[model samples]
Target: MKYGVYLRPKPERAISGDAYTIREAEGSVLLGLADGLGSGEEAARASRLAVACIEEHASLPLVEILQRCHFALRNTRGVVLGLLRVDLQAGQVRYAGVGNIGIYALTREPFHPISYNGIVGYRLPRVHEFVAPYHPGDLFVLYSDGVNGAFHGNEALLRTEEDPQEIAGTIARLYGRPDDDVSVLVAR
Candidate 1:
């Protein structure tokens, strides 16, 4: 099954805060979301750096891929990471992230948030690998920073939406705050 992706970020002057991307191939798929530390270029920079590594190493070992990213950002301000890896043939998904980046898995439930352990920056330990089984119709939602005006960042839509990219575009156009970056990606 092919996955749909969506994204929404706050702010109009500059996209700072949220970063995300989706890559679907024959047997492999990758979804990434990053939240820069603050608003403006700083947040955008951090988010860009975080997702860049994930996109670059989609085929690498999950643990190593994250470690390399963590190390790459060691000299800069910390950022958050929300990533999803799907093996189409295997019917499995590996979900992970740090900081405020979030994940919502849509199974039978409506909104399910998959929590992560630590923050991505400076001297943090590598994240533990977490794997979950996936079905064809399952929905995955990824969000960055504080979505629009809501505190605690934005939320993900796993249960309700069928078109991830459309959902992402809609969210960006609808609730995006005048200040801050908002990006969303949905896949299933």
Candidate 2:
């Protein structure tokens, strides 16, 4: 399977504490987005550590990765994380999230956001899982909490186009607030 990824990290409130990464491997895509507690260098560090944890175990199961991160961040400031694992050949999408992660599968119609609860490194232990729908031309989009008030871009462009970076940039550029850090991932 082939894919594209685009990301733009910004420091909105003079602190800028968000980090993300999207990796496409042999059979799956490892996508992670995190918001480190508050703002400042500490926040950035938390976000970075969260993403690094996910990348380190990119080969593991979704639950295993989440569990590892949960343990690793126990002593840190913690972060809100969204993890997506896509099986290209199996035609499946797996979601395990803690905190503000807006995820969707856009086809001809847009659906409700996936149910996510808890905060990594925080006291919230709510962990939920969902199986996302994967279609031939369906686009999967995920964003951080800073993207709460995004413009969302054109569903048409997302469906007709295959470039995830452009789509992510368009969404970030148009929707991201000046006082916010926007990180996005688009997959089809």
Return the top candidate by lDDT.
2
Name the regions of candidate 2 deviating beyond 4 angstroms.
Answer: 1-15, 108-115, 149-153
List per-candidate RMSD values in Å. 4.0, 2.8
- Per-residue CA lDDT of model 1 for 1-188, tens digit only, reads 45554444443544556667677777878877777676667767776887787778777766676677888787667777877787878977787666666666665334344546565766455566568776677766676654552422344433444476666566556655546666666676
Each prediction's total of clashing residue pairs, residues at least 3 apart in sequence or on different chains, is 20, 0
TM-score on alpha carbons, each prediction? 0.78, 0.83
- TM-score of candidate 2 versus the correct structure, residues matched by position: 0.83
| Local accuracy of candidate 2 as per-residue lDDT tens digits, 34-77 | 88877678878888888899899888887677788888888889
Off by over 4 Å in 1: 1-9, 108-113, 148-161, 169-179
How much does candidate 1 score in TM-score? 0.78
